[model samples]
Target: MIKEVGIIGLGNVGKVLATFLKANGMLYWAVSRSAADDENILRNISDIKELPSLIIIAVADKYISAVSEKLAHKFGKELEGVFVFHLSGALSRNELILCENNGAIIASAHPFQTFFVTGNYENVFVDVLEGISWGIDCKAEYFPEIEKFINKLLGKAKYLSSETLAKKAIYHASAVAVSNYLTAAITLAKKMANLADIEAEDFLLPIIKTTIKNNFSDVDFPITGPIARCDLAVVKEHLENLSVKPHLQKSYAFFGAALLELIKDEKIMSEEQIKQLEAILLQKHLY
Candidate 1:
């Protein structure tokens, strides 16, 4: 039933959301300091108080609190039934107190997708990543209408209770770690490929695509690298090479420990082999 929307913060996330909303035939008003960049959205309002029925704040986390408060104060009287939602992955609905206090229905609708600055949209997210959405810290009865609307209109949205938003935070973080951190790891792999006298991109095609393919079907253990084979010698050599990049070394060791633990559950790695990797990981201060 919520048709008209006002979207703030026209960054990557905001821009993508706007594109989807417009293509879906929703009457939308997008706002930003550089609103002139895109002249084709439904409408670009300069004032937050003049926002439509639904105000989607896609601003930075630091700005979400202050900006939501200012908007609430400005539209306190007029927000009788308007819905004000933010697109933050980490913030809960309690942070949206300003809107809730002003009688505006508030929640968080986070689409689990990446932003490609390049111009392309088809199959960008597909089944490789899923959308996980949750609401603010408020009673379900207070915003059941919005919850139902989200389920009907948006991507596969799952409801998390207000009090359970913290648990939902972990869920959201895991999604980001899988998507964002995977990209970082691949970038490192490409760099290592270049350093090893192989064309970085030449050998990346199947491995990259196949990894995504595997993830789409199931959560299979990574089977290519040393960790997959529990190759202690190769893993130790990797640790020695990674000593120069201390932060990356720690990250690799920490995640490697978790992955090592996972594979051992399936009896892929013996207890002795798992401890061997854990010992190397501890040397990197990642215990």
Candidate 2:
């Protein structure tokens, strides 16, 4: 029953969502503290003339609570059956709990994709939202309407309970591991490749893409490398050579140890071979 949509904040996600809503001929209003400088963003209004049925607060995480409080104070007196939501991946719905007390519904929708403000707004607004997974934390009563809106945007909502919301830190950590750490890992690889007078794009990118492709499409994708082959000698040589690079050495040891567990579980290596690799990886002498 979300008839009118109001968007607050004109940052990356906000811009994209607003653009999408406008393009689709959806009735919506937007408010932002600062004026919109980006040509792609429609001019933002300071306040809504008629309160919208759905209010999407897309501000930064730190400001969500403050903004929610402000909204509850400003319009809570007349706001009824209004649904207020934010687009923060790590913040809980409890941040907008005040709205619920004011006879408003509260929820949050977190798009799993990354948004770079400088990029093409049209593409990010359209392509990125299509069939993407959204992490939704909302009151049980508000779920159906939220899910409907998410479907309209071509996204699937993964509902989370309050208990799950309490674990947002861990959930966000996993996302950071895949997104941010992947970038960091590539940076390290490029730096090491620089030592060899090699360009990462020319040398590493194809391999990276292929590995990622396999990871997604192939469940039984057999891992290839010294660890998978149980080639203890090569692993020892790597450990010894990488020792000079503390960061890479530590990363190798940690991941190598984890791979040992997978190999053991799969019965791919004999117990003696696993023990030998484990000993080399442990490097008890280092401690």
lDDT for each candidate structure: 0.69, 0.79
Give me the runs in candidate 1 sitting further than 4 Å from their true place: 23-27, 34-49, 120-154, 161-164, 215-225, 237-258, 261-268, 281-287
* Candidate 2 TM-score versus the reference: 0.77
- Provide TM-scores for the models: 0.75, 0.77
Query: Residue 220 error for model 2, in Å?
Result: 6.0
Worst 10 residues of 2 by lDDT: 38-47
Task: Report the C-alpha displacement of residue 91, candidate 2, in angstroms.
Answer: 3.0
Per-residue lDDT of model 1, residues 217-253, tens digit only: 7665556688877778998888678777776667667
Steric clash count of candidate 1: 2
